[model samples]
Target: MIAPAPGISLGIDIGGTFTDLVLHDPALRRSGSLKILTTHADPVQGILEGTRRLLGEASVEPGEITRVVHATTLFTNALIERKGALTALITTAGFRDILKIGRERRYELFDLMLRPPAPLMPDALRLEVPERVKADGTVVTPLDLAALDAAADQAVAAGAEAIAILFLHSDLHPAHEEQAARRIAARHPGLSVTASHAIVREMREYERGCTASANAYVAPMAGRYLARLGAELAAMGIAGPLLLTLSNGGMTHVEEAIRAPVQLLESGPAAGALAAAYLAGAQEPRILAFDMGGTTAKLSVVEHGEPEVVFGFEAARQARFIEGSGLPIRISTVDLMEIGAGGGSIARRDAIGLLKVGPDSAGSEPGPACYGRGGLEATVTDANLLLGYLDPSRFAGGRLPLDRRAAQAAMARLAAALGITAEAAAWGIHDVVTEAMASAARTHLAERGRDASGFTLVCTGGGGPVHGYHLARKLGIRRVIVPPEAGVASALGLLTAPPRVDRVATLGRRLLAWRAAELEAAFAALEAEARGVLARGGWAEDAPAPERVVDARCVGQGAHMPVTLPPAPWPTDDAALHAMITEAFTAAYQERFRRPPPAVPIDLVHARIVLRGAARPLALPPARRGWEGPATAHQRQILSGGCSAMADIYSRPGLMPGFSARGPALVEESGSTLVIGGKGRFSVLENGNILVELDA
Candidate 1:
């Protein structure tokens, strides 16, 4: 093995179909990347193999790598598949059914048989103890130690591998919950335990309980996976500090990740959004990040060089469009909308003989029929193959050769059912999936009071560029930017992430009767907590100053909006502090609602602080100056605009910065392909990103 070089960073992203890896030397301004089919049985196997290949191809030794950052969808998949450990919940005696009762609001009012997601803990495993804590941190009744012991014993007898403890109003008064946790830990040292107050200190009981239950459910599995991965990497002679990306567009150490795996639910997609923001922020202040992989498509908005952040999101929804149909997790995460439209989404005719695309996919194991992996059903990839949009011999960098005949046969079966030619059926499938994605984009934007026409579309992932032009045209977007190595962009994103942690506390105080010292104390405590977390991740020395935000609302309003506040050492006078807070809140409120409300008393609900560590920026390699070789590598017949045309094919790497191509062209690379519509004009930017301008 060649001696390792210093200062090399390795980033790995595990997707549904592929595990992408990127090894870059920031100082050298160079990079090497690889894509391997994911091993469903053991994801670590794919990660190890891809790592070895990437290091060898880049001519660097494992010891030379200084950092390893990873993002995966494994935990999210476990939640959706219901493959987590047997978990039990321990709560106040009368509030045992809080998980099941939920908010009691029907997500869908008209459906005759509406089914909400089942609680992570069933009734049999939900053991309760006699405890009482009021909403104001007052103890209504003392906790019964004997009752708590009995519940612990019952949970153990029921074969629970993990236990979640949620005492009523514990967010404000955590002493009782802490006492119970210590007792349970002492009795069952082998079991994993999670407490509601430790995870989220907000007001809602149901949401906090759900969050704790989810963390306990996935804790055992995530711990084991991280342990095994760490052992394997150590055995491979890699001495780098392993970091895991969080769903909030930040990275944390392996130990912190194991403690709170729920924060990693959308980690992979968040990385993709962050990467888009970094690459396109200079050219466009506002961008719509569209990432289409093998199993799903994700959309997120990036404004002013940062992705929007949301405090809560749902997972494993029974109905994608309906709220409250899935498990609610209250964690800071990048705001994104995900739909089941991707390359491997299955296509079939409905009961009434109407063609439909998926909310289900033929994942990597039996990937689209074109991969010749025993799949017979027609899928989006099969349709793309029949439409001549994908090269059979070059798929997955030639690691997986696609079978054109198999794709044709699969489409033929669907075409027979539709009573149309295979080509027409293929077009129908393509158009259907494209429209599904566009419609979803429109709805997502509308909900934010924004329109798609105002944002530039930045495309990434394997299927993103292939469908970017059509989706852009549908959304009334005129420009699309496809960065270099777009297929592995998320892995590249992992390289750019900074170490960060967010902490929140409930204040629940009225601004009209507030004290400056009390407010300062609350924010200071949150900053200290955030700093400790960042310190554990090896960012203690140069962590950036904490950013503070407070959730405020009209005294009687049920909800609150987040207001960013200036750093600590606030005004010493109470009246001055109140004026500052009210002014900031009013400004933010007016911007959001388009008008200011009448003079009213406001209350502070929660205080939040974010701690970030500086990460070195990646330099873009200089682009080739001229296109000396033949621009047209070959010609292939493709279906577009309801007709077939001979599209000129070009090699993506061979195109220089000033290279330009008209519509009816295909730009091919190792892992992705860019399809230019008949009326689109494509050009290469200085940074090697391809810009395609759509014709209205």
Candidate 2:
């Protein structure tokens, strides 16, 4: 067994509104955490400030930190805000329109004015060179190196800071794309070069091209930010390697992350899902991991102790719920749904005078009016304050006090506009946002062919616990689990993620025609590449055997289903291996479509391998020795179900395992609050997590 490193391991997650930090001391079995508003202009500023505060409060020295895992939405924000570096794309001749053409499918068919997301690179910057590689890995038209070099020079002269090289069928034969990348990098030493094959080996030229372009677009900015963050940490006397959490719920070295920033698009939300899986999966395998932060609410599913993962996702959509309206990124990501209905989500009357909760957020700069951060608009946070769900004196652990008057004043405007009382308006805002989240969750689960009734809702983030009970009731979920350190759950997730690398290669071939030796070789090659990546990320020892998955589809079908195969050292007999693959595909197809297709030929579309290293077990502070009595810290009047009532307010720290309370009640912790509606019951679990069960 490899001995674990000594000292503290820090996990930092920068969200849309707050930068959360968690410092765990394995030796002492203790953890300290903090949350600070994110600095919009410079995110690192918030990170640095939060880091300093956490360490100081914990009385730990910088040198005591052995490792730091960081996750952020900065790259995603860059893509959404269009603040990334100037970038260009170079592809095979005649494929310059691939980005623009983009599958040519309308996400919304009935809408006459449906608009697709704009390509990262404009037509003028999407230069193409003569290069073509056949689907069978044969070079049809050799790459025009001189022409590529000239085009690269011209792109650089045109102020392209990064260039994405994507040749036709590069997934089948990457030599041309790789050579063009080399030529561009050699000619322009400082320019960032992204080859599609390096980012994704899957087929589908348009998605691959989009992923490569997005990577190149964010590479320069991500690199600069990471470099600056590393230097800053080093200057603070912490010398540990800085790791980054990926959208796929794994940790990789900063170097690897900077090279493919597209993988970091869902980094922050992925961590929250990981945390949910880690903390609640043992008790409930099927869990709805709901995280409501300051700016957004994300819902992911965890089944059988693992979060659901998807091969590709769309980002920065013009229409939030529409699939094809955003940029397609072909990278493995935790499958989740995000909606802008967080605490900082702006709430106001729409043009028709109907109250509307966000898809727009005030964020941290001028957060909710209750935050007293210069924001005049009412938000979910302000509404919560007006409803007495949030205590003005104890918000955010009292690091930032809530202004009750400001909150009331802000909501009063909306109330006046609606001809309702401020409290009534606050309830409307709260109900709208909660319903929005529940609706999104329902849609997400329905799309996966799952129902929310049987799954437990594990809530995290600043607003998650506060709203968990109501959301659970709406979703027909009886139980909701709010883990310890829920407000900083994403940061805690960063600590729980194992070092993993997922790699895939396009392998378009009929199952019956495949050679055992060739198939084995392909799997072996992918495993080797994944292992190399894990080694570079400092997890060389004790890496587990790679898990293999095949993307298979019936011949002539455009879509494919991922089928997990048995562990490696595949059968040597061709018939046995073929049968094994066929059975798995048939079973998966039956499960999804209710029955297997009539006897038909199946083809392997992509071969995937995931290499995972054993994650270090995190030792949370042990639960209190014994349960005390009711332990009511105080009593407060709270509005619930349109009725005002005096509720027992309990301090979370004072409650021990087996301690139970009945609602209406407020369980107060430093960074978060758990609200239990009328007839609801909450109990502290063995792991110090709060499990709230709502009455039917």
Candidate 3:
């Protein structure tokens, strides 16, 4: 029985196929988790159903949930489906076509028929106002209030619910943009407005404008959803504050999130990365985090307990793997790579008579054929069910039963297309998806300069653990870790993430001549703004001092490298501090380029700060200890080496710590299981994690 405590922290993550919920009671050091099929039409409905069921099953009241953190792919889906509110873009006069006239370079170098992606807002809705600011924070043409009103009038008259304002050089001087914002707000009180400077304070005009418009495109939709969700949660008697996870894996109150929904993009994958880092611990300093959900699989690298962080990432790319083929979203984000390998991925024969797994998925509405939700397609899940990798009677803890006959029939239809037997088709689908994952992993890891053999694979999400063993084998990894409740690890990550805020400002000064006082003043101003953001999230008072970073580059270089400042309370002497900054930049430069410092002076393009609160203490113990139970095993027919083999299946929850078993074994749990190959040995570890050691 779960004993009542002061309060419970609830973590919820909504993915393409499943919605996972975890309730953690810090006082008792206990957690309860649940996975439910996602409601495609109304995602919140799934949350309501899952939450009520989990609370009741765990014997907890709604009021006991003191903290609520949520992460989802909702915003990403909204962008892809073009389901955002009608939006308009307003820019400085003569720059109405800025979004259309983006960079000259093509993402696909020699593709003859290639065309750049269309702007988020229509041309007719992109209005311009009379305003200008010089490159170095000087006002050239003052804001014309009359022109601004005319632009606002056009946007509102065009039935736009949200508007994005972008003034050239706003990053260096934001006065005109700020003034225009005040005027627009006063005139159009109901329209959601996003200022370019507020979203991205950088030198790139096109990128900054695109980021702002994207935020505005989703702002109204997110605001309505968050408001409605918050009210409903209050009505449900859960009075705690509702927080949303950001792309960088930090929690922020609902109000702050509503203002900038772009920051919440790809947050689900980031949470999964955090969970992997947490589970890896210090012992496994290097690991690959593979989170395979229903729609896609997310892969990330974690080193020394920290997942890699990148300054920005592309979203909803036209060419999925091409960098510049998508909208440039410049925000601090976890560096994660995604592949089209998931349980719901559809399998079909291409025009070339080659079998191909998906970049398209069968979402929960009509999931896999075995789900019995009216789906007719043979998906990965359907193949898994046919291979006996999944139990028909005990799927999702019996809440959702698998229809084995339906799965077999679907596989037969697919096999007919490829001139093969149904059983062969089933294994084909399984192997195809695993190979796709391995192929993508190799490319991503190679780009990051990492070798797969040196890293331990940490698997999460519903599908990761089941296919992880072979996936590891394909990558030449010898060890794999499947944490307790692997299916709900992403949600659990939300419970442990700290509240964090990131701030950035363009410096536009030569570091050699910049005085320490001048730099400190600028950074101080940014820190104050960041603190205000934290204050809005109710964390500023107790949050630690922010970390400092500088985007430094040579005088003739187009791009800058980020260098972090040593520590807080910088040196009082100007010469001493300048020396510290110079030394750090040279060291970072030498490390990346492997050359001596250039003769040219260095330019400081942008300065950044990250303020964060302490994370919740929810790390698992080294082992489940005295709670061990019997590791009784049973026999089951599992597909192996293109044939049926009887494998020893053990109950995961009943297995005690240190329980060891050979390969050709299945470890079953309430939500998911571990499918080990015949070439490895599997064991239950001290912290309730399952460790599989592959044969050399």
Whole-model lDDT per candidate: 0.88, 0.90, 0.86
lDDT of 2 by residue, 1-696 (tens): 122375689999999998999999988999999989999888887888888888999999999898899999999989988989899988888888889988889989899998888988767899988888788888788888888988898898899999998888889889888788787888899999999999999888889988999999999999999999999998998887888899999888887888888999999999989999998898897999999999999999999999999999998998998788999998999998999889999988889988999989999989999888799999999988888898888888899999988888999888998888998999999999999999999999999899999999999999999899889988999989999879998899899888889999999889998989999999999999888887777678859788999999998888998999989778899999999999889999999999876698999999999888898778888876543445665788889988998888887877879988789999888889999999699999999999898888
For candidate 3, what is the TM-score?
Answer: 0.96
RMSD of each: 2.2, 1.7, 2.7
Q: Candidate 3, residues 150-172: lDDT per residue as tens digits?
A: 88998899899999999999998
Q: Could you tell me the TM-score of candidate 2?
A: 0.98
Off by over 4 Å in 1: 1-6, 625-629
* Ranking of candidates on lDDT, top first: 2, 1, 3
Overall local distance difference test of candidate 1? 0.88
lDDT for model 3 = 0.86
Clashes of 1: 0
Leading candidate by lDDT: 2
Per-residue lDDT of candidate 1, residues 501-604 (tens digit): 88878888798777998888888888888877877766777586788899999988988888998876689999999999999999999988999955889988
The 10 consecutive residues of candidate 1 with the worst lDDT sum are 1-10
